[model samples]
Target chain A: MDTKAYIASGILELYVAGQLSEKENLEVAEYAETYPEIKKEISEIEAAVLALSEAAAPNKPLSFEAVKNRVELSEDTKLIPLNRGRNRWLPYVGWAASAALLAGLGYFYNQNNQLRSDIKLAETEIQALEEQIAGASDSLEKTTALLQTLRDKNVTVIPLGGQVAAPEAYAKAYWNETEKQLFIDAQGLPEPPDGMDYQVWSLTLNPLTPTSVGLLENFQTDENGVFALSNPNQSQAFGITLEPAGGSESPNLEQLYVLGTVSS
Target chain B: MQLEELVERFKQKDLRAFEQLYAMYARNICGAINTIVRDEVLAEEICQDVFVKVWEKSDAYNSSKGRFFTWVLNIARNAAIDELRSKSHKNQKLNLSADYFVGILERADDEPNGNVNTDRIIGFIKNLKQKCIELIDLIYFKGYSQKEVSESLDIPLGTVKTRNRNCISQLREHMKQN
Candidate 1:
């Protein structure tokens, strides 16, 4: 029999663990008896376990006298000192250890709490990241829709030039005639005052009439200086004007920031 | 004397042989018992009783049952489990980490629980892996079968034997070093 193969099988360790069946135990024992190398390996494994188990033995004076006194069968009565073993605990010392056990228990309890808090912190971080991802996806969807609208064949691009009120201001209007929708990119325009907003007007040059489109609501805080407004009338020009917060019923000619006419 | 020879003598009811066997195995047997009972005094008491029973049932112990120490370990574990069940109403909650015998050695540096030489034992097995600690605890101390350990730990059944062998090899290496 290959003793190395037998030792590597871990049967001897299981034998020492006493988890092997009786038949298996008999086979292992027979192998050990036959193979000196297998026998040595088995004993070494047993010794390591013996050392570990001995480490858990309580600290007490070992005297065979204590056990000898208890056993009276006496094939021959001879007292010998227990030379090596560390023996078991004394009663009082074992009892006193209850307090020490409590202290150990408290330490483990605190460790458990710390681990729980760590998990909670990790879960909170995951939730915050999830919220950020959701916000990003929402913005991505809105931008995609705006891109599709701007690229539509029915849409007309109208460039707006800076007016006398604010020569530096420039804006562009994207008009999708089929859908009666207008998108204004006012990236070059300055932010409106706290109590005021910029409104777009659909103007017909023949009558010199201006129809209120919609206010550029929340323009100061809007990172994307883009707005969508409805324009149903046949308009020759588009103008943006700064008005009081809600938006004015008509364009404030003095505050006209930009003026643009349809290229068509 | 060789362990086999001592066992042969012990079977013949030789008082010297019995004393030698008890002295050889008593500490390890008691320590193994304490891991279960978690009570040193009770474990010591059980250890004494187990030795007496081992003497009484000496003829029944055979090579087929395993090594002499394994037989004693079986008796000690059964007695400890019996007592634990009777006293289960007293709130003896055991956590996975702290209840293990290895836990004692690992925690022995600062907290003096279990045996006096535990810190020394920690020195011997300081570099031991967590998997090794768990395998040793379940197989040797808890008396779990390889299949039971595999299921409980959710490891492949074949891994149990090989892992335990490696762990024992590591332990032997540590012992040889220290």
Candidate 2:
């Protein structure tokens, strides 16, 4: 089974918290004995909990005598001393040594479990941090690419001022005439209403004609709010109009949100 | 001696073994009781009773069931909650606040209160998220089950374990920082 995934699932923490069911408790104990890493994790989680609960202890220490006096010891049991003969002493010695050996084994098992878990935690932490670094580097590369495109000499940056339909709205168009590609920075435009979309049009001002380019779909959810469309037409100006979900064959002049003339 | 050995000796009615285990967990058990009872002197009294009960019921504990700490923790909390419920008719009705151990931290340092480990406790929980604090209190202190925690916190059932793991992870980071 995926022991690492099981460890990461947080079940061990609940096990230490004693929140798991009877079956789950037995399963965890079994896992702890079988998997050193799980055992180590259970130990650390137990320790963290122990520390928090310990810290909540009242300022005054509870007298050991207080607890000692209240607890009744078994009167029948008595400790046998080693002052007697060798034969009598040998069994006691044997039991003591076996107990000692058992204790030693338990101690080493605990230590080994602890070390393995420490290494596992360190590895998981390092993995999380590496993922973060990779994510940051990925975003940095994309930003750098966007910066290069904006600085390209062949691209014309046309500032599209807000139109009367929505005076506060604005957008920018980066027209690469040679490549016939238009990049729109629609960051300044408000979100299109439900079931509506913003459509871009390439216009030839001489006859007041406009050809629909593309609709900015998924505008609200898009992180950058930038749309790129191919505009192969020999256009004199550009305008954006809001229309029903899909782009219209002809631009709706009244719904024009922004317009800008391209200077030749 | 290893914890298993100590616990073995404890189960065999060895006073020294009981003393060792008591010393290891007395404050923690008492603190846990205090979270429920909300009174230091009363909590101490209940804490002592809990230890005595631990001795009487030593044979019931098994490694397979749970950790020794967790076993005793259940005893301590149950005793405290019983004490609170029994006194429900008193003039000062006991309300087991959900805040748990944070009460000691928020109390003034000069007040006549159980302030011994408040500083360390504050350091341990410093900068922890509020949700983490509540989760720890509910599960660790109040002994809520996974389903109960999900319902009380209004989060998805599957989220409780993973979310709790992350919270405790943050808590461990706080401990390291201190």
Fnat per model, in the order shown: 0.76, 0.73
TM-score (C-alpha) between model 1 and the true structure: 0.53
Alpha-carbon deviation at A129 in model 1, angstroms? 99
Over B33-101, each residue of candidate 2 has an lDDT whose tens digit, in order, gives 877777788989999999989988898888766899999999998998788778853555643434556
Give the native contact fraction of candidate 2: 0.73
The number of clashing residue pairs in each candidate reads 0, 0
Question: What would the TM-scores of all predictions be?
Answer: 0.53, 0.54
Cα shift from native, residue A61, model 1 (Å): 2.9
The lDDT values for all models are 0.83, 0.84
> Taking candidate 2, what TM-score does its chain B reach relative to the real chain B?
0.89
Model 2: what TM-score?
A: 0.54
Q: Which candidate number maximizes DockQ?
A: 1
Task: Point out the worst 10-residue segment of candidate 1 chain A by lDDT.
Answer: A77-86
